[model samples]
Target: MHRTWAIIGGGNGGQAMAGHLALLGERVRLFDVFSDTVNAISRQGGIKVTGAVNGFGPLEFATTDMGQAMEGADVVMIVLPSIYHEEMGRNCIEHLRDGQIVFLHPEASCGALAFKKLLVEAGNTADVTIGAANTLLYSTRIITPGTVDIFGVKHSLYMAALPASRGTRLEEAIGSVFPNFTLCPNVLYTSISNNNAMMHPAPTLLNVARIEAGQDYFYYTEGITPSIGAFVEQMDDERIALGEAYGFIMKTLRKSYFDMYNSGDMSESDSLSALCKKVVAYREIKAQKTLRTRYVLEDVPYSLVALQSLAKIAGVSTPCIDAVVQLAHGMLHGELDEGRTCEALGIAGMTKADLLRYVS
Candidate 1:
């Protein structure tokens, strides 16, 4: 029954979500740490969402003020990349209230645990329930300063809360806003389900030459050749192995790619190169202009590193994951280690059984 929403991020997903929520007749406040985006949206008279979801929804409160953004809000949404999750939690922890619900749009690897760590470190004992979506509700891009192009909206998504006991309550509250959400067993269920980590890093990393050359080509179609697909398959094996260790099975990389752009039925080409030819949304998504993009910078650290570290807890070997990290370290000259770690996430020294009990 709570309708007041505070969306934290000015990225495409955040703007699109604000519009969709407003279309549902809910009151929304949007917060971005970036002042320029806040000022731009404010000066433009609100956000304009186009493509998949279209509308102009005025953010009731838009500011850099964490206090102003979070005050009186029923749900505070994290809509940015996982790289910002820790900082966001740290920034907003002081103002988080007892009944507030903080939702991570797409739970990247161990995101719920990392954000919750920030809260606990800040001494927050508020009855705040932390939850995360398995995948972003929308495939979107900010077309302009205050305009966003939404390509797709996920029909159904899984979400879960830490401490599992709060899952049903959070589910019912969010179900009012997005009726298709299904409550998952725990945060790792959603974290392991992240498709972006499986999809982004390899293709982008393998195509560094094209990206650095500022080449404009369809990333999936041209970049992820059958050869590169082999690397992705190897990486996926490492990821799936860790998940299997915990009695969890994640979608195969091929199935995930098909689900995003084609009929999700397992009838398509299993070859990643052949499968990329089927993606429609990625037709114009050119390679990054530099090796510094999140495909390498963020995912290698936050996504792959978190997974590999957790794999250690389960006594799982992630040689493929380590290979990518080693290669990225060579390319980036060592900013790679700064991403999320189970230790930094406060899950260090935990065994597989210990982690299950802790996250659950």
Candidate 2:
């Protein structure tokens, strides 16, 4: 019996997951909010992918209707942004049955915990398992509405569960499909492990003028020279310090990038420089001429802002993180932290003891 996998969002990430599962002969269902995107995918036969992975073919299923897409799915991968996870979880509360596992990609800032809370709030407590991938497996792009180009899958992707008891079972479920998945100690590690909040926003926000000025640039490689990379490393160090103060083990941004790019056996310096090369190659292949990546739009509120709150509770000073957040706000025109903050996620106002009580 083949397990059915449902990937929501139907964007690059969703399409890539669906394509992989379908290719493996699993039943894969894809859904998105935009009808045009769905129509484009269906009309084009399937998503066309390039680089390390390649080929284009038909998907097992694709739909705009959420409930219909989730029917009979053994695993549901929420590939959408962190903001949508809560509502998606609520919707699943009514539809998801026992034995189904909902996996949040990257689980930005403990999003899995919030999603599970939403499910509980909906007055439904079926034995549906909740989990999250530490980071998105692929660094990809949607060349067209119907095509996805996968850069590579990260090594050492992490996962964890709510209530801390379902970790093993959820890991077993997701591991059956993605053998590379590793179980994290808890959601806190998985949540804060996202370096995009630290790395992406700094460069994108700092280089906003250049981005807006149409100065044809590739951010990580060309825009982030030695000095900029040094600043990024410093910000990453602050993030690690915050995690350490809370008594957690967080990987450096360099290691995270190396893991994502699969640059194994490479020295630390070699690994970071390799990552720079990957970023450059990515821009060239995609013909990207702007700095409007998801680092600021997706990473700031989801990852960095969340960490800032955590640092406050842990009594850690995150000067670099703070500066980047303020800089991102100044550049972006609005406070990304307005509605979604640690408090909004139920972590704010809680003492360090209270947080450790849950995480521990």
- Candidate 2, residue 338: CA error in Å? 2.0
TM-score of 1: 0.93
- Would you give me the overall lDDT of model 2? 0.73
Best by TM-score: 1
lDDT of 2 by residue, 241-326 (tens): 87787777788988765655543544567534346656433445321344345667667777777787788888888898888777
True lDDT of residue 85, candidate 2: 75
How many residue pairs clash per model?
Answer: 0, 0
TM-score of each: 0.93, 0.86
Q: List the global CA lDDT of all models.
A: 0.81, 0.73
- Model 2 residue 39 CA deviation (Å) reads 3.5
Task: Give model 2's TM-score versus the native structure.
Answer: 0.86
- Candidate 1 has its poorest 10 consecutive residues by lDDT at 260-269
lDDT of 1 by residue, 1-360 (tens): 537889988788898888778767788888887898889888866788888778887768678887898899989898988888877878888889998889988767888888888887888899999988877898788888788888888887889988777897676778767877878788877777766777777778788888778787777778888888888888888888888888887778777667756755335666877877766666677766778888888888888888877888899998878888877888889566577777788888888899889877
